[model samples]
Target chain A: MTPNLLVFRVLRNPKVTISLSLADWDLLLRQARCSNLLARIHSLLNEQGLIDRVPPKPREHLQWTHVIAERQIKAVHWEVTMIRKALAKVGPIILLKGAAYVMAKLPPAQGRLFSDIDIMVPKDNLNEVEAALMLHGWGTTHHDTYDQRYYRRWMHELPPMRHIKRSSVIDVHHAILPETAAIHPSPDKLRSSACSLDGYDDLKILAPADMVLHSAAHLFNESELDNGLRDLVDIDSLLRHFSNLPSFWVVLVERAKDLELTRALFYSLRYTTLILHTTIPPSTMVAIEIGRPNQLTLTIMDKLFTRALMPDHPSCSDWLTNTAKRVLYVRGNWLRMPPLLLARHLFHKAFISPKPE
Target chain B: MNISTLTLSELGHRLKKAGMFLQTGTFITHLKTSIPSVAEGIRLLYADYPLVEHLDFADFHVSLTYPRNLRRWLKPQIQFLFDGKPPFKPLPADQAFPMLEWGLNWCVSSHANHYLIIHAAVIEKGGYAAVLPAPPGSGKSTLCAALVNRGWRLLSDELALIHIGDGRIVPLPRPISLKNQSIDIIQSYEPDAVISRKISDTMKGTVAHMKPPANSIIRANETAHAGWVIFPKYQSSVPAQLKKLSRSRAFIRIADNAFNYSLLGIKGFETLTGLVDASQCYDFTYSSLENAIETFSALEPPASSK
Candidate 1:
C-alpha cells in the first residue's frame, strides 16, 4: 500500500509533523478534517509535546478542532446522564462505542467527537426502553414505512431516536449485529459479562475483552467508511489500553472464538497493525491466524480495506480507490442479511426513500 | 501583487488553470472558476486585494463550477466546491458571485473559531472601531457603506472577528452587500462607489456588492480596538438619534448576534466582556444617511475613568 498521504504518515508517527512545512500542514489539516480525525491528530500531537512546533496557521485549525472536541466531551457526559435518567426503570444499560469510552474514561474517549449516544439494553426490554425514551422527549427520526419495518424486523437496533428539544440522537440496540447476520454473538453473553461503572449501579460498559471484539465486529461489518479510520483508531486504542491487564490477549482471543467473531478480530488486528502500526504480540498474531481467510481472499480483502480506510479526500485517492470503497460498501450490506432481503433493502433505499445525509 | 495588476483575460486564464490565491485580511482563499461572470465580479470588486503566491498555504481551497450533468444546459446552475466537497446545494448560474461571497462567509463562521466571530458590520475612524450588530433589513450595510465612503475604514460588512486574547477587531474588508433599495441608495449616495451588477431573486432579495475603499483593503492587517457597540435601527422618517445603552444589555445583545459565542463557551464570554467593557454601547436610530453620518462622526470616546 502507498503510505504517502501526509495525514496517515503523521498519524503513524506524530513527531514527523514537527518538520512539515506550511504547504504540508495545509494538506494535513484538510485530510484530517475530511477523515473526521482532526481532533485525534491534535490530541496525538499534544501527547508527544509536538503541538508547540506546528506552524501558527495549522495550529489554529488544530486549536479549533480541539475546542470542538472539548465541547463534545462535556455534551456527551450531559447526554449520557439524561439518557440514563430517561431509561432509569427499563433495565441495565450498557453504554457502547463512543459513549462507553467516555463514561468508562477510556483512552479513546479523549478528543473524540461522536454525534449519537449509543446504549445497549436487554433484548427483552427493548420495547419498554424505547417507549420510556419516547416519553422523555426522544422520537424516531425515520418516517419511511419501509425503513421502519426493515429496522424493526431485521435489524439489531430500533430506528434511531432523537430528542425533541436538544436534537441529540440516541441509538438503542439489543445486540451488536443484525438478527439476520451470519454470526450471532449472544447479546445475553455480552450483557452477562458487562462491568458496572463506579458509583453507578445500573450503568455498565462491556467487559474489557467484549469491548474489543464489539469494536472489531462493528468496524468490519459497518458500511459507513466516513468514520472507518476513526473506528480503527478506537480499536488500536482499546488494545493498547487493554493489553496492560494480565492475560488480556488470551481472554480476547478466547472470547472472539466463543462469540463466533474471530474473523472480525482477524481483520481488526491485521488492518490496525498495517494502517495505524498498532502493536500486537507474535503469539497473539499466530493465535488469530485461525480466523484468517484463504490466501486469494485475503489478498483481495486487503486491497479493498486498505483503499477504503484512507482519508476521504481526493489527495489520498487513486483511480481504483473509489471502486474499492463501492465493493466494500456492498460487502458490508451482504454480511448483514440474506440475499433477497439485502436486495429489497438496497432497492428501497435507492428509489423508494428520500435520501438521508 | 494586487488582482488589479492582472489583465482580465490573464486573470481568467490563471483562475481557470491553477486558481488565484487571493488574500483578504488574515485569510487567503484559492479561488477557481470558469464562469466569466464570477471572474468579472472578482475583477471589479476585488481589484485592491493582494494576491498570494500559488504555492502558499491558503485557508480555503474553493471552486465555482457548472454542475456536470444535464442541469448545465437544462436550467443552468453553479456549485461552490470547498475542498472538493459541496457544502451547499447548487444555485442559479447568475448567482455564482453571491454564492462565492456566501460560501466564503460560511468557511469563516463555521471554522474560524480561533476568534470570537460576530455577525456584525464594523468600521474604523481614527484609531477606534464601531461594531454595528443588527438583523437583516436593519439597514446596517447601508449605514456601513455610507460611513466607509465618508472616510471611515471598512473592517468588515458581515463578520466581526475579535481577537480572543486581546479583544482587538481584525479588519476583513471585502465587498459591502446591499439589498433592494439600499443598493440604489448607496449608488446615489456615493456616485463614485463601484457597485457590482445587481443579481435578483437570491435567497436574499436583489443584492449588489459595493466595492470596499482601496485604503481599507491596503490597511487590512491594521487591527483596531473597538470603541463603540452601536445597534443601528433604520426606522423610516425618524430623526437621527443616539441613546445610551447599558454595557450589560449590550453584552447580551451582542452575544446574541455572534456566530460562535456559544461554541467558544467561556473564552467567548470573556472576550466579549472585554469588548463590552472597553466600548461605549449605544442604540442609534436614523433614516437619512446624511444625518446618520453626522451623528456617528460627532461621537466621542468614553472617559477613561469609567
Candidate 2:
C-alpha cells in the first residue's frame, strides 16, 4: 500500500478519534526523514492541505486524493449508471451524496468518496419502491429484531440492504435521518429542495441546505462512525463545499429549527469543525451558535444513545464503550435507566436484528 | 473433498477450524479467467439457496459460483452472501453445518461464475418472481420454502441473478431452507413435503433444507421477469395484507434491496425502475403462508402496457 494509504487506513480506524495524541504528533514530525513511503505520504497529505504543525514539505496528498479522485470518479460514474438504471423507470429522482455531487460536476473521484449508494424517495412510495427492487433481484441485508422494529416502527427508513446477485450494497431512504422525528420536513419540500444536473434536466438533486442539513442530521441521528473513515470525511467534504454557497446558514438553521434539530445541528457542526479542522468563519459560527446544544437534548442523545443500537461509525472507541460518552452529560427523567436494555439491544444488535442468525 | 453431505453444524466446525478469512465482505480471489466478467455472469445466472436460520419466513435464495481452489478465500465469504454474521465474533460452534458451507462453497467457486453464493428461498408464480430477499428472521426462507411446497414455482432457494444491464431475474433453483417453526409448518401445510434432518441449537436456532421442486431444478438455466418486489413482515398473528405501491416509491425501496445497485449506476436504476413499472408492488404482512399464496394467486399482474 502507498504510504499515504497506509496512513489513511490507520487514521480511518474508528478507534483513532481526532484526538491526535502527543505520540501521533511526534510520529507526524518524524515521518519526513524516515522512508520513501512516509516521505511520499507526508508530501501528499501536505499538498492536499495537511497541517503545518509538523514541518513544511511540498504538498503531495492532494495528488493522492486527486489520484483517488480520478479512480473514484469513474467508479461514481458507474454507480450513477446503476442508480439511473434503477430509478429511471421509477421516476426522475436525485441521487444523494457521493454520486450526486460528482454528477453535479464536482470532482468525479475527489469530490466524493462513497462506499455504499444512498438515495431518497418520497415517503409515501417506500413500498412500491422497495417492491420494484425486490422484483429486480436485490436482497435486504439482515437486521435484528430491535433494528427491524426501529426501522419499521419509529424510524424513517430501513437499514442498509444488499442484492442477491451483486456485490454492492445500497441504502434507501425517504428521509435524511431516521427516528429523529424532529426533522419532519415534508418529503415534497425536500424533493423540491433538489436541483437537476447541468445536462440532465430530467434528473433532480438535494438542495445545498438539504445536503448540509442531512449531513448534520446524520451526525446526530446515528453515524456510529464505525462504518468507515470515508463517511466522516464525506460529511466533512460536504460541509466545506456547502459553505461556499451563499445563504447556506439561513437554510441550515431554518430546516434544523423546523425539524426541532437545532441542538443536533449545533453539535454536528461543532464536532465536525473541531475534528476535521474544516474551515468555518466566525459569522457562520455565530449564526449556528456551536455548542449551546440544549441540556435536555444532549443528555437524551448521550444517554439513550447506546452505540449498540447505532448503524456503525468509523470510531474505534467501541460502540458499547463509554469512553466517548463520558465526555458528555444528561439530566432528568432519563438519568436513571437499568442496564438490562443495554444488553438486550446489544444482543439483538449483534445477533437478533440481522437476518435470522 | 466435497462438504455438502455433512450437517450444517459439522460445516460450522470445519469453517472455524479453517479459520481467518482475509478478505472482508465477500471474498473474491481473482485469477485468470477467459470470461469477460465473471461477476456479471453470477449476477445474472447462478441459482442459489442460503440456509442461515436467523430470519422470519418468506425470504428468497440465490447463489454465485466460481472455480474452486480459492476455498480458503471463499470460506469467510459464505456467511456474508446470506447476510450471515461477519467474522465479528466467534462463529457459533454449529457453524460447521455442511449444507450451508458446502452449498455456499460449491456455488461461489463452482466454475459457474464469480459470486460467493448465498442459499436462500424465493417464490414465483405466473411468470413473475417476487425475490423474497431478506436476512433470516424476516421470515424469508421459511415462507419461500413453504410457498414452494404449495405450488409457487421455486425460482431459487438461493441467489437469483438480475443482470444490472437488463433487469431480468435469473432463476437459480436450489434446495430451500426451512428453519425452526417453519419446517413443521411446511409439512403440516403440505403433508408430503420433503425435508432434511433438523439439527437443533445451530447458530440460527434449528435448521433444515428442503429439496428444490424438481421442475425448478431443470429450469435453473432460465430467467424470469421480476413482477413484484415486496418486503414481507410476518408477525405470529398478523393477518395477511397486501398494499399497492407506486413506481416512484418503489425506486427507493428496491434500491435498498440491491447488492450492487451503486456499482451499476444507471443500469441499476433502469433495471430496478423497469421492474417496478412493469410489476404491481406491495408491502405484505402475513400470519399464514397459505393465505398469502391464495391471495397472491388471485391478484392480477400489472396490466402490460399496450
Model 2 lDDT per residue over B144-186, tens place = 8777766778776556456444666666564566678888888
Give lDDT tens digits, candidate 1, residues B104-131.
9998989888899999999998788999
TM per candidate comes to 0.98, 0.42
Candidate maximizing DockQ: 1
Model 1 alpha-carbon miss at residue A102, Å: 1.5
- Per-residue accuracy of model 1 over A176-258 as CA lDDT, tens digit each: 99998988999999999999998788799999999999999998998768798889989999999999999999999999999
Candidate 2 at residue A47, lDDT? Answer: 42
